[model samples]
Target: MHLSFKNLFFTIASVFGIFAILILAKPVLIPLAFAFLVAFILFPVCQKFEAWGANKIFAAFLSMLSLFLIIAGGLFLFSTQIIDLSENLTEFKEKILEIFTDLTLFINQNFSFVPELERGELLEKIKSGLSNSVGTLVGQTFSGTAAFFTGLITSIVFTFLILIYRDGLVNALVQFFPENHQDKAHKMFKSVQQVGQQYLFGMFIIVLVLGFTNSIGLLIIGIDNPFLFGFLAAILAIIPYAGTLIGAAIPVLYAFMSYDSLWMPISIALFFWVVQFFESNLLTPKIVGGNLKVNAFTSILSIIVGASVWGVAGMILFLPFSAMLKVVCQEYIELKPLALLIGEKNYTDSEKDDKPGLLKKWGEKIKGWF
Candidate 1:
């Protein structure tokens, strides 16, 4: 009992210490984490370039340049649409006011206990609130853009250096383990790298597939800037389940404001729903495979914890980090339970222990036909 209590205390203390450090050191750690993940995805490409007669530095630069070009091109197009949208903000505000007035009137008529407020007074108050919010938002957006660009440069620099010194980094990490476990350490390193690359590459494919499909659907519905909204949604979809929902909101809001009829926004929502449903069920599994599969509950919890700890970057980073953690846990006897906790049910040892019944296996096979 005493030993168990001691172990419990140590576990709790360790978790808290790690969480505290993550929250406090986020400014530096966020970029480092971004660099690390980017390096994982880009290292193989750099090696390919080097094998083709390029030097390591040049290879790394080429890899970074390729990524920068893709991002810059997308941003250039998206920003153009955003500029157009901003020019018509006054029109959108007017439509919003009309909707708000209707909502207020309905509430006032339906409920007698509620105080009947003057439409002009209510509009004035709402206008003031929105004006303040817009001002704050614009200020934050400009400031944040500068910070984002600065961090992007830092991440690119770190990625290049990491690719150049990756061998040294691997050796240093392996040295942390004892001589007896050095082989296990090397295996762990390979497994983690494989997991990162697979997840990232799979996600990239998913984004392209989603972007193309979403653009087609939006165009069918006659939405403006279909490519911009589609690609933006696809990029944000990297954040897991919540990201799809969040991305869908962007186009839905624009459709709502741009069109006179409510049908456009409704159709956009339905289209996103259908696309997300298939992407989650079919595309993700087929391309990404089950290498990094975590249960939905754990995925959501990790995202929430990540957001709390490091805001947006944490949300993007923690899911892959958790998958890597699970991979490491699976190699060690003491940590196996943790691996089980974070992993998907179908992927866990419990499922392996009790050979799945024939009926269950058949069910899975039949379900896969969809």
Candidate 2:
């Protein structure tokens, strides 16, 4: 009993210590974490260039430059789309006011016993609240913008350094373990690298497929700025359950505001539902693969924990981080249960294909009779 209590105390203390450190050192640590992910994505390209006879430094530089160009171009396009969207803010505001008017009328009609406030009074209260909070909002926006740029610069620098000294880092990590376990350490390192690369590449492909499909569907439905909403949805889909709902809501609300017909908004919702269906059922299983799949409950819990700890960056980073954790867990005998707890049920292709139902057997028999 004493030993068990001692172990429990130490475990709790260790967890709290780690949490405190993460919260306190977020500014530096978050960027370093992001840099590692960037390095994982760029590592293969760097290796390819090196294999083609370029020096490691030059190869890293070239890979980084390529990534920079892709990001800058995407940002340029997104900024232009946002500018176009902003130009119609007056129209959007008008629609919002109309929505509030309709909502107020509906509530007043449905609940005659409830006291009704004047629409102008409601608007006045909202305006006053906004005016009072303006200063706080402005301060936060400025601080956030500064922090974003700082993190971006730090991550870029760190990514380059990581790519340049990757070999040394690997050796250093391996040496941290005892001499006898060095081979296992190297294997774990390779596993981490491969998992990170595969997961990131798979996510990239899913995003493209989702974006294209979403845009095409919206365009066919005759919505304005289909590409813009589709792109936004694709990006937001990275956040899992909550993100898809929010992403779909944006387009549905826009469709309602932009179109007089109720069918347009309904159709928009249905389209997203169908896209999400394909995504979960077909795209994800086939592309992302079972290897990186986390249990649904664990994934949600991780996202909540990550968001509480580190905000939006944590939400984006935690999935790959969790997958890496699973990989690490699998490397140790004692941690195998942890890997299983967080992972999805794995089925081999033969097992999946070998399951033939009674209906299938009957159909085969009928076909043979015909």
Off by over 4 Å in 2: 1-3, 77-80, 101-116, 346-370
Summarize candidate 1's per-residue lDDT along 298-333 as a digit string, tens digits. Answer: 799999999899888888999998888989999999
Residue 2 lDDT in model 1? 47
Which candidate achieves the best TM-score against the true structure? 2
Could you tell me the TM-score of candidate 2?
A: 0.88
- Computed on alpha carbons, the lDDT of every model, listed in order, comes to 0.84, 0.84
lDDT of 1: 0.84
Clashing residue pairs for model 2: none
